[model samples]
Target: MRKNRNLIVLNIIVILGALVMVFPFLWAFITSISPGAGLSSTPQLIPDNPSLSAYVQLFDRLPFGKIVLNSLGLAVLTTGFQLITSSLAAYVFSRMPFRGRNVVFAVYLATMMLPMQVLVVPLFVEMKTLGLIDSYLGVLLPSIASAFGVFLLRQAMNSVPTELDQAATLDGAGHFRIFGLIVLPLVRPALATLTVFSFLNSWNSFLWPLIILRTPEMKTLPVALAGLQGQFTTQWDVVMAGSVISILPMLALYIFTQKYIIQGVAGTGLK
Candidate 1:
């Protein structure tokens, strides 16, 4: 009886904790669809009368679609670039024997712990010199090569059995062909997780874009969302609508790739 009671209490505590964590998202979601007026005084989470006016005004007041497209474009392009660069680097480090490979890999992984903010000013000056400011390439450049991705893929690649690579090589396969045909297929789960994470990070990046993009046309989702705030009183409902718009894609991507994400982590080091 004591154990049963203790379990019940613990479950209740966990449920309450989850609700506490989820409360902000629930509020943001509810408030987005709510009309702007009387939002502050609403005694309940769900509006007395739900409306889509906030979402309507969000796009009508700004180029919401353009910002969404820009964000999506950057996310997709950056993810692709990182996947290729990191995977190749990881494969080389894990499989190919070369001089000073451990030393180089150690240096590379150490660099990942360094914050990108330290590099932003120099990156900005370089972009300006190259006339890349306010351009998509400028937004995508700093994120193209990722050390986190490299570390992750290196660990994943190392787990892949050496037998597969040897068999491929025996059949007259080159390194590139072997990677493309055998190693990549074996690490599909890791690639899917990496792709989803890289895409979300790119989509949500705000500070760099705000500093790099001067024109309204070049602004991505988070920057454009920040623009919803002004010198005067902010539009709470519209801001919330924009917030939902930005987060929904990430949620959808996570949902779709959740299996791969968990499986990738679970499968690590079994070989």
Candidate 2:
């Protein structure tokens, strides 16, 4: 009976926590459907007469389609490149032995500690020197590789039994064959997790894209949505509408990959 009561209390707490986390998104959606809603308006769980005029105005004011495409393209490219690079690097770190390998990987992992803000100036200058400023390539080149991806994949790869590699080697299989046929197939969950994370990072990326993509047509969703605000006045409805739209892809992706995310994190021994 005591245990049952504790479980009930825990269930109630979990429900309350979920509501707390979901309230902001619920309010955003309500505001998005509430025409003429502003920042100063009273919060309402349900609008009196909900309309999608804010959504209509969102597209009218911004090149939203192009912005969405830009974000989507960058995110896809970033995820793809990061997967390839990080996987290859992780395989090397996990399977291959070399002098100073651990030191090199440690240094690489340490780079993750340096915030993007610190690297922004140097990256911008490098982009400028390469004549890549205001170009998608400039935005993409910096995110093509991720240290966290490398670490996560490496950990997953490390957990794989080495006897498989040895057995494949005895069968005259090369490193590439072993990687593709044996190891890669086993780490699908980690790959999915990385894909989701990389896509999310690139999709919500604001600073680098904002700096590299100067033209209005090249702006990503986050930066373009940010422009909805004026210096002194802001339209909450249209902004909320844009926010809701921006969140849909990520929400859908998480829903789809929720199982893989949990499994991947668990498999990797990550907290």
Candidate 3:
């Protein structure tokens, strides 16, 4: 009877926590469908009259399709480049033998500690020097290589048995051949995790794109969403609608790769 009581209490607690977490998304969805709704001190959980007018008006008010395409293009390129660069760098760190390798990797790892704010000015200057300002390449330049991605993938690679690489080497297999045909297939969960992370970071990026992109046509989703807010008056409903639309792609990706995320995270520490 005591155990049953404890289980009931635990279940109730979990249910309450879940509700608290889901409330904001529920409110956003409700607000998106309630046209002309302003943010309230006490937000209404349910709308009296729900309408899709805000969603319609969202596309009408802005060139959101262009913005979305820009974001998608940038994100896809950034994620792809990160995966390739990070995997190569990680393989070197994990498998290659050289002088000062640990020191070099340590320096690389230290970079992840530095916030993006510190690099913005120098990156902007470099972009300006290359005449890449106001271009997608300018926005993409910094994200192509990721320290966190390298660290994650290196840790994953370390968990793989060195015997496999040794056997491949004895068989006259090159590093590229072994990496492509052997190691990569084994660490798929880690790659999936990195893919999700890289995509999310690029998709939700606001500051860099805002600083680099000057034209309306080049604006990404977050920047375009920011435009929905007025200096003195804001449209809560349309903004909420935009929020919903922006999250759909990410949500879908996560749903499909959810299993890998857990496995990757848990396995990364095993090395």
Q: How close is every model to the real structure, measured as TM-score?
A: 0.91, 0.98, 0.95
In model 3, the clashing pairs are: none
Residue-wise lDDT of candidate 1 within 1-271, one digit each (tens)? Answer: 9999999999999999999998877788788777764346553575777888999998898888988999999999999999999999989999899999999989988987778788889999999999999888898998998888887788888889999889989999999998999899988888988899799889889888988999987789988888888787787888888888888888899999999988777766422
Model 3: per-residue Cα lDDT over 171-234, one tens digit each: 9999999999999998899999999999999999999999999999999999999999999999
Each candidate's number of clashing pairs is: 0, 0, 0
- What's the TM for model 1? 0.91
Q: Which candidate should be chosen as best, given lDDT against the real structure?
A: 2
Q: Give all candidate RMSDs, comma-separated.
A: 2.6, 0.8, 1.7
How much is the lDDT of residue 21 in candidate 2?
Answer: 99
State model 2's lDDT.
0.95
- The 10 consecutive residues of candidate 3 with the worst lDDT sum are 40-49
Q: Give the Å shift of residue 187 in candidate 2.
A: 0.9
- Candidate 3: where are CA atoms >4 Å away? 1-7
Model with the higher lDDT, candidate 1 or 3: 3
Best by TM-score: 2
